[model samples]
Target: MSDTTVTSSSIRNLIKANIRNYSMVLMLALIMIIFSFLTDGVNLNSRNFTNIFMQNSYILLLAVGMVLVIIVGNIDLSVGSVAAFIGAISAMLYNSGANMFVTILLSIILGVLIGAFQGAWIAYAKIPAFIVTLAAQLLFRGLTYIITNVSPISLRDDNFKQIASGMANINVLTINGVYYTALVAGVVVFLIYVVLEIQGRRNKIKYGFKVSPMSFFIIKLLVIGLLIFGLSQRFATYRGIPIVVIVLGVTIIFFSFITNNTVIGRYIYAVGGNARSAKLSGINSELVVFVVQLIMGGLTGLAGVVFTGYMNSALPQAGNNFELDAIAACFIGGASASGGIGTVIGAIVGGLVMAAINNGMSLMNIQAQWQYVVKALVLLLAVFYDIYTRRKTGLG
Candidate 1:
């Protein structure tokens, strides 16, 4: 091939490989801008911005686990149902005068058992994940209904309520009506993010891998820093800092580290890429699948707790359609349909995108049916984009 042709081909391939990464972020920004305008700037109001996090917290947690499942070439349609079942259990325990700590622990244990049961059927018995989780979806939902007997379980514990709705106890300062606690937290987080990113780039250089230009890197960090600080300021105006946000931040950091820097993470991608090939390479594909599901279940339990706390009760229908939202977030954030590709950050952005759309539409008094249609179209387009890119790169 001519040098010019070769250069053009390489550029095209690069774009195909990474377009989703850029597009997801840009799409979120675009959505925020559009919704801000559509809602007459109501969407960007301090209270509304905080509501976005509080409302979508559980979904984000589910999306974190969902992305990992997708990366391993599996799906867990039962997450929402499992969450509801666990939440129901927690509510019953709380109402029975059980200690909040004990209630949480038992709920998580229930989640583990449920995940292990489904994982065994799918991984050990050689059943398809779709069938196993689909069955689980019905089973768990039915269990939730049976346990609650079609009634909502109310929680009247103040300590339990703080799990999702409480603010941070720390106070940095109160300056000109802006709570400095949020800003300080944002600054600390931004510094940590920047340091880790720069260190990662250095490691890439040390390993003889390609790296982005310093200019590009700096600009990217600046943009992300501003976004972090900007949102923190907004959050400060409402509540100093939400406890759930702190929980989410910690979870994201931990999972992001594991997926990028751990051996098990590589095995997950390998199995997803080709399970048979991975097994032949001496990787225990079944064990990996089993462990992934177990982790997913634990996270689902955590989500259940947060969600239950958020509503101050657990209704039989509380988690209805939550799985769909989590799955959509993964795909929309750029997870490959056939698996072996995704990121923690992408899933967060995708969930935020979904949350933004839902929140914005509700603010405008749009009907539920139309909201569903719009979200369905958006999810379809996102999957289509994934397929188009994969085919272009001959990976489909």
Candidate 2:
């Protein structure tokens, strides 16, 4: 082939490959566009944009842990109940002595214990995860009521409340009568891309597999650019990006890296892909499940702190129905039901998809019932597409 013709063909291939790789992201963008039109741009406001992210952080946190659980061919239906139970305990401690530090530490410890108990049943006892967690849902939820007696508790600690409300200004940027924190975020993202690229290359070489070309890297960088620019503009008119955004950003990077780069992450994936095969391959499936549950419990504890601090109060049902949201987020993020399939970026985007729908509908003053209907349709369609694509590609 002529050099020019060869170059043209390679470019087209790169473009096609990227679109296939990020098909979910494109769908999310389309949804955003539709919402922007319906809301008359209200949903895209810098302040509202920041609000969407902050409001969804708890679900995002849970979804991260849930992704691991689902990847290992199990589900934890108890996280919502567990989170509420812990919050209830925290409230009791607060209501009793108002010792924020002590209460927080106790709650985290409680989370570890709860998670380990459930993990032991599912892993060591050979009980199905769904059943163990379902029982936990009932048990912990009952404890939540017993601990608080159905009374909502208010947090009185000023510093505790500020943990989720405060913003750091060092990264802030003022532009065109607005402020932006993404300039710093942009730098961090670029560095992350470089690190990921180096690691991917190293891994491909280590495994002696063919590495993707620079064109692939270019596409990845371009997507990152779009993300930073779009999100930054959404926050440029506000005071700056909120601290919650930073927290979520860090969480995304850490989890994404851990899952993509670490040995633990691969074991999780292997266990999900095939537990029996993974075990025969010398992977400690038992340890993997245990650690997954351990991390999940810790994350739930963290989410409780965030939700309480953000609201400046802990309700009797502080984490009501959050497990459902996390599950939906994972499924909608393109994870397979049969397990061993998901990405951190996909999981984060899935949360954004939910937030976008919520924010957009609220902006348009749509009734809550209709919002549910619309979201249900979106979720169903995403799953249907996932199954269809996998079958079409013979991935099954």
Candidate 3:
């Protein structure tokens, strides 16, 4: 074959191999377009779209951790209950006139302790995570009720509430009545993303690995950059970028870096890929599992803080079904049910897909029952796709 033909084949194969990496994002965009049309523009309203981010902040946080848990071939059914328990503690502290900082600190420390306890059983004692976390789900839920007396505790601290509802504290500029902070941030991020993409392609080519054609790479970057810019413009017209958006963005970036660049991250993937082999290779699979659970607990604590702030209260039912949403997001975002195959970015896309569906259906006046049915169907399809891909790749 000619050199041109070989290059073309490499690009084609690269696209096929990584199709799932971008599929969920495409689905999310398609869902947004469809809902925009169906809702007569209501679903795409700047406020409504931004609300999706704010509303799903906790689920997104849970998703960041849940993907790691699922990738490790384990589950965390206790996250929602842990969130509720933490929220209750925060509320109790705030109501008792404690400083907001102290309340948050204590809540997170308690969450870490809870994680350590559960991790010990699942990791060291050889208990199944499903059973352990299920027990913890009931245990922490009961504790939430005990703490809150099966009632809601209202929040009165403005600072505490701001974690979920506040906008960025500073604005760079305003042009033609548009806040420029988000737009500027969007541009900066786009530049960084483009640089990284180009660098990745170069590295792949240098290593003789297959890579998408330059044309395809450019197109993908353009679409993604435009999406970010457009979303920022929309938010610019409303409130400045939200504080929760910053939190979520930071979480995604930080975790992405951890999983992609760090030795600990490689160990995690190794453990998930094969615990026995990983242990033999000195990867410390149990330690990875334990640390993952600990991180999940920390994220759950943060979610509790955000959840409480969003509602301005902590109640018995505050975190009901949250763990389910998080897990579904992971599965829908292209995570393998078996383990060792997922991405931080994919989890975010999956969370947004779920959030978009919920927001769009509400805008269309769809009944709650139908919303559940729709989500169930979508999740089923995603898992089926994962299984199909695994089988095709001989991983199943």
Which is the leading candidate under TM-score? 3
- Report residue 325 deviation for candidate 2 (angstroms): 0.8
Query: What global local distance difference test value does model 3 have?
Result: 0.89
lDDT of 1 by residue, 300-329 (tens): 998999999999889899888899999999
lDDT of 2 at 186: 65
TM-score of each: 0.94, 0.90, 0.95
What 10-residue stretch in candidate 2 is worst by lDDT? 12-21
Question: What's the lDDT of the predicted structure labeled candidate 2?
Answer: 0.80
* Model 3 TM-score, 2 decimals: 0.95
Better of 2 and 3 by TM-score: 3
Model 3, 228-283: lDDT tens digits are: 89889888988878989988888887887788757888888888889999999978
In the predicted model 3, the residue pairs found to clash are: none
Runs in model 3 deviating more than 4 A are 1-5, 195-210
RMSD of each: 2.3, 2.9, 1.9
Model 3 worst lDDT run, 10 consecutive residues = 8-17
Per-structure clash totals for the candidates: 0, 0, 0
TM-score: the better of candidates 1 and 3: 3
